[model samples]
Target: MKNLSVFSLFLVINISAVFSQNHYGKNGMVASASTYASQAGIEILKAGGNAVDAAIATTFTLAVTWPFAGNIGGGGFMVIHTENGEVTTFDFREKAPFASSKDMFLDKNGKLKSGSNHNTALAIGVPGTVAGLYDAHQKYGLIPWEKLLERAIQLAESGFPLPKSLANDFFQFAEAPEKYPEMQSFIKRDGKVVGFGEDWKQPALAETLKKIQKEGKKGFYEGEIAEALADYIQSQDGIITKEDLAQYEAIERSPIQSTFKGYQLYGMPLPSSGGVTITQMMNMWEQLEETPIIGSVQYYHILAEIMRIAFRDRAKYLGDQDFIEIPELEKLLSDEYATELLEGINFDKAGESTVTEIHSIHEGQETTHLSVMDANGMAVSMTTTLEQGYGVKMQSPDLGFLLNNEMGDFNAVPGKTTNNGQIGTPANTIEAGKRMLSSMSPFIITKNNYPFLVIGSPGGRTIINTVFQTILGTTVYDYPMAQAIEAPKIHHQWLPDRIIYEEYKMAPETLKALEAMGHEIQMRSFLGRLMGIKYNAETEFMEGAADSSSPDGGVAAY
Candidate 1:
């Protein structure tokens, strides 16, 4: 691995064989779930663009190269650290359309309609990706918007070979191809869907990108594309309108900040629960006497307990700050609150769910993350999503992008509990033009007021815990970036009262120990796909790591 260059590893290794690879560079770095997207960002950096320019380029390129999660019709959050030391956050989360109501997913009998918000047309929300990218670029980008979009447009028009990961996604959704004819048409040839290594083209989507490059935000929100979006949605019995598209705007918000072990952590604020949850968990961990031994039963037990406590608060109080009065954030991150929560924990046993107040359902795990840093000291950590894979399984015929099922993220029926034990709460209840609650946590860490780590992930409700563990692994346990990200993870949300972990990742003895402590253990194939970059100013090198579980993830530098 040391002998091979990062780009060389990207080309020579198969997906299954590339997990251990890490990239290092002296100038700049980009880490993402797709090699193509990472390279796109590196290209911008090499061409004299700043971190924001590279991030925008990478994001657009992902829409073309990694469509399963990357999307122009979705929305997300971005945490930015400027070269001059300014920290800001941008919220481009999707909003409920004007015509949507609190009971939209409830039937005439006043019961929640089963699966109405999963893959149906009615699940679509007003998208904000286009607006968000445009706003970020306009404010901080050095290159022209057209230049940043060139690679994505070219990829869409000329086509690229389908990756195995994307092929598997197509196969998984094969049963519902007819439901998303526009997307199917792009991935199919000779009336049959293409598989891995086959050429996949999207001329229609290229045209959409061209319009965006030419007309800016209006290209997506107010003119031909918006008209097509509204028409197709209405035809499918969805209620989004052209007015909703035109009215959408991505707002810039202050990032939530906290400190642990002399490192300052900055993350997205509500409508996302990630930042607060991570801060609370870290604070609780800091109160401990010493770092728990990694991979030990005590390590898993303590982290799980902390996660349960943070998630309980997340469910009880987290919501869109613009619409609901959230608990005082500063207090939540205070040492007193963390110590108070920590005092209730029993080191030998799992605690009972003390939170009776419920919140909304969890967001889908089908989201994407990217981390970027430039030599000038600008950094970005972003996580974007379309809710579920393929979103609502529908696309606008002419616009040629998948629409987000973000409305499904809302709590459709207050007081209802799902199989996962997630209970609905009024704080996240559906409301016209209101942003839905999110678990997408994009974050950046600074040491002595300088960028130290740029990181984020896509794991729905587990995002907060995944990021928390990764940071702990790096900052407290003294693990390198690659090992920290690839290390086995454990998670426990409060209501479920079960610790879900990767099968075979934990030792049998450790499992027995946790089980003895009354932890109900559940096994899963994986937890989250994390992308991160760590900057060592002393060494003058940037180390980039992609989750071992991600199929196409890679790091690029120049």
Candidate 2:
């Protein structure tokens, strides 16, 4: 595998450069929401920073340029594959505050409510994103911390023309700033929401970024920024205290990985139901090697059936294992169990959506994903979030940040019966210091013992389905990354009792066939956003794709 040249890397990153037109070539690859963020990473690589360094730089810059989704105010998870073959998953998802209770969202009659009154304040979790990024950089970063943030600061100070997607998102939550006057100025204009193509600036955010760059993670966690965030929350009659801020920190967790065929799959674990569920789906899919050829009707049927089984298991048995025992996951992915479930599939018919009693809800579904691979073969698949977009719609006026609505992740139907028995089980119910369950699965695949593909997506419960389809498309159907991601995607969460399809992508005949099998179908213009990088480890050439749903998305390979 030949190493990529520095000049080649630059050509791939410069958005205005002619070389930008080509999505892939030889050097390295980066796909993110901001061109400036991507360029910052390329710059780091050119200055001798490794893949991890570039990932850190790109991630930090995103926290600024794309504040609506990715932010320093929120935290997330990252799966890093170091040059030396070390694999680690960073857990920076927000943690339940120390003052939280099991029945926080439960009402007077012990019923659950989903509105902002009980959810807005004190219910928010302590953020781990900053500490998580710092931890990754402390061990793997080559460029200085300040240097990594320079691009973000410049982008913030210069003010970017808001992209159409962000403008739309802002309009959807226009009431946010009014609810929290501290944020009224930026989110609203002339007491009204801003329109698309308008100029949006966050000097407060810029100042905050500069402060963090100057003071490091501590600046945000223990200093003025923390004080402001705490004060503002308190002022709002919320529950986050300075003590919560002080106690927050990200944890380094081992990614749950398994081999499929000859490829290795690495993903986040525990609070993240992604990796285990994905592995279970893969196991079920692997069982169909005999009859239904890949890509045939039988193939689609098998894939859909397997996914239904996996998701059924997910909806019931999976949750924040850090808080509950996800005992079924280990057994679910076990070869014997997978084979047993696979045996249950009737080759001639699509199985019932609830063939198995998998109980995992798609929680904390709002997320953004990125995939990067440098010349050194170090790859990263990361998904960051504010839970749902514009999380909680509450802004810490003094801190210049928005908190997450992760509490919405718990089961709202308290005391309902689950296949496992008892819906309001203590395992997944909100508790002080518990991390919300997540479906952000960042995965990497290896072929012939070398990195082949790094993939992930952001769509709450749909994330697992999206990743499953793409992997099967690429490995079984032999589609390229572009084709794999663009292929029609379907999802069947047991509770929904319907197979949802992407609009106009699935064949009409296929739709008829699915319907004939007693499957209800619904269509949507868009689903989750996915990005992937396929490295030809043998030749060292790579190709990457950023989701087309995101107007700001792009793939650059040097």
Candidate 3:
């Protein structure tokens, strides 16, 4: 693998520069939501680090540079494929506090208490980011852990101009900070919320990072920082305690493996429905005779139908594997299951459906994803989130970080219809120490035993469909990596029974054709922000692209 580094570097420099919007490099590449974060990963790679090292650097840097989504207070999943052909997954998703209960958010009327679990201290879950990163570094990192913290620490202490995207996010959540005195103090400038382009610094977060750097994971879970976080949450009516933090652990799970059109796909397994849903959708689509043309009416309709079927199963069977009797993966990915699902779809019209007696849980769309690959062929795709923008909309005043409202991800009440019209299943019911079901899907695809595509997105329920479309575009449709990522995407998650697509991203005639087919269509501002890096086997160079929908998304390679 080391011997291939020189050849990769040469190919990266001479790959015809075919895709202008994508960053291409032979030695390494990093695609993330922030330019600074991506550069941080590339720097680690250039400094003789492995893909895992670069991923760690990028993750921490994003915690400082892309606050709304990138985070230290949040939790997520990571899928990694090492050069030696070994694949692994890390489930660092937040867990319910011991005091949490199935009906904690229910009112006296037995209905979900509106906004009770969304933006409050009680919404906070035990954080796992610090623990997860530390575990990953201990296992696979090549650089000193303190080295990765330097950039994030400096950025938090010295401050950086708020990028347009983060600034806009701040502005949108402007009124939120006013409710929490701690948040108000951080964002206020002379009694006004900080505006876009202002220099923003987080001294408190820097201090917290220093502690973690010195004491490893214990610095965050057992020491002064943990005490402060627990005390703050308790004062705010939240259930988090020092014990919850101390008990948090990032588990290394087996990567869900499947094959699509002769290419192998590796994704994060349960706790996340991502891997199963993706594999199921692909299996169903494979039953079709021809790949639908990208952006065409037939294409959208077929994909939407497939998504609907997959999401239905997602709701029915997916959850924390440890707690639920999840369906067998072999059976779910079998051709017979695909055949059974295919029979439910009518290509000529949308299928009629009714809400079932189940619970519908929705994870927030506010999240971040990053993809990194080193010249050695080691690759990583990770999706992390705060559950919502500035999660729970409550910052830990002492910690200078937001707490995850992942508790909202649980089914608050049975027999209730979610805002999206999907019923929640018992499989997702909350329990003490139970991990919430998530829609995050980070994946790595391999061709003939070589790394081919590293991809993932940040779009809550839309993540499965987004990654599905990208894979289809690149593999089945033979589109370039940039085109596959930038192309319009559509989503349909069963109970909703309507195709949601980006406005004007599809041709008017194609949309009209879909309408004629009896499909209900809805327009959305955007569906997802996808980031990916494709390994060009012919050129031996990696090409990375950031979704056009994300204004601040960037790619760096060297």
Please, what are the lDDT tens digits per residue for candidate 2 over residues 466-556?
9888888777666667666766678766655677777745556666666776677889776677888887655668877776666676776
Model 3 segments more than 4 A misplaced: 1-20, 172-182, 189-192, 357-360, 418-422
Compare the candidates by TM-score and give the number of the best one.
1
lDDT on C-alpha atoms for all candidate structures: 0.85, 0.72, 0.83
- Write down the TM-score for model 2: 0.90
lDDT of 1 by residue, 119-169 (tens): 677899899998999999999889898899999999998888999988987
RMSD of 2: 6.8
Estimated TM-score for each candidate: 0.95, 0.90, 0.94
Candidate 1 vs candidate 3, TM-score winner: 1
The residue pairs that clash in candidate 3, if any, are 358-424, 359-423, 359-424, 359-425, 360-423, 360-424
Ranking by lDDT: 1, 3, 2
How many backbone clashes are present in model 2? 14
Candidate 3, 1-558: lDDT as tens digits? 222432332243234223327778999999999888999999899888889889988998888888778888889999989889999988999999999988898888887777887878888889988888889889988889888888888988998888777676666556664565546655655677667777788888899989988888999999899999999899889999999999999999999898888999999999988998899998888889776655556677888788877787788778888888865667887889999889878988877655652323576998899999999989999999999877876776678887788988888876567646535567888889999999999999999887899999999888889999999878887767777787778888876668888764665666667778877888998888899999989999999999877778899999
Model 2 misplacement above 4 A: 1-22, 116-119, 171-183, 188-195, 291-296, 353-365, 417-423
> What shift in Å separates residue 531 of candidate 3 from its native position after superposition?
0.6
